[model samples]
Target: MLIREATEADWPVIWPFFHDITAAGETFTYPFDLGRDEARGWWLLPPPDRTVVAVDEAGTVLGTAKMNANHHGNGAHVASASYMVDPAHRHRGVGRALCEHTLQWAREQGYRAMQFNAVVETNLPAVALYRSLGFEVLGTLPEGFRHPRHGYVGLHIMHRAL
Candidate 1:
């Protein structure tokens, strides 16, 4: 698989997976009905931030990640990132690769730490992957998410120093 910077042309391939993943209510906190324009702006950030995608040998997008500063001004040294893998491509390490790439990019951009602000507690695979990659659970918000199936679930704040 090839991991590369995402282009505007890649949105068509990313939208379906982004829509479905957000709608699933299993991981992300985004509204299931989030509009296209907002999603586009969120994914394709300007300047300092970067977005990337993982594609198979055939160029089918398998996953993606967007990374940027966790906050502004004095807090700018901390970075944050979000990731999504096509459900059909789960268990294939796409998420891992995207994360690895994102981290490297964050370091190159001079970030001192990386954080995930709202990781769903029940998303074990993702949580585990983050853990394996050196992220530690900083805290958890009780009943932070209204999971469609699991009712109320905790949202974790995971962080790693660069």
Candidate 2:
């Protein structure tokens, strides 16, 4: 799949999976009821940060990622990123490709480290993927998320040096 900078036009195609993923209320911390316009703003980040989509040869956007500084000023050296893969495309390496791309981008941007602030502990596939990519869990907030099916679950703070 080809990973490239996302364009405004991609929003329409992206919104469907994005909405489904968020509405699932099983992984992301975003409000399940978050509106489309607000989600567009949140996912399609501004300059200095980046938003990208991974597409197949047919140009089907299979996944997306948004990356930026974890914090401003003193914390600017650290980076952060979030990913969303079309559910139909899971187990096909779309998420892994997006993650590897983010790591490369972070390194190229001179970020000292990258952090994922809210990885749901019950999302075992993601947890394992992050681990395979060298991200370590710094800590977990007990009962941090109210998963739709699992009740309360821990939220992990995962990190790795670039």
Best by TM-score: 2
Clashing pairs in 1: none
* Clashes per candidate, residues 3 or more apart or on different chains: 0, 0
Q: Compared with the true structure, what per-residue lDDT tens digits does model 2 show for residues 1-162?
A: 999999999999999999999999999999999999999999999999999999999999999999999999999999999999998888899999999999999999999999999999999999999999999999999999999999999999999998
Q: For candidate 1, lDDT tens digit of each residue in 62-99?
A: 99999999999999999999999998999999999999
Q: Any runs in candidate 2 off by more than 4 Å, and if so which?
A: none
Model 1 misplaced regions, further than 4 Å = none
Question: Root-mean-square deviation of each candidate, in angstroms?
Answer: 0.8, 0.6
The window of 10 residues in a row where model 2 has the poorest summed lDDT is 83-92
Please report how far candidate 2 places residue 71 from its true position, in Å.
Answer: 0.6
Clashes of 2: 0
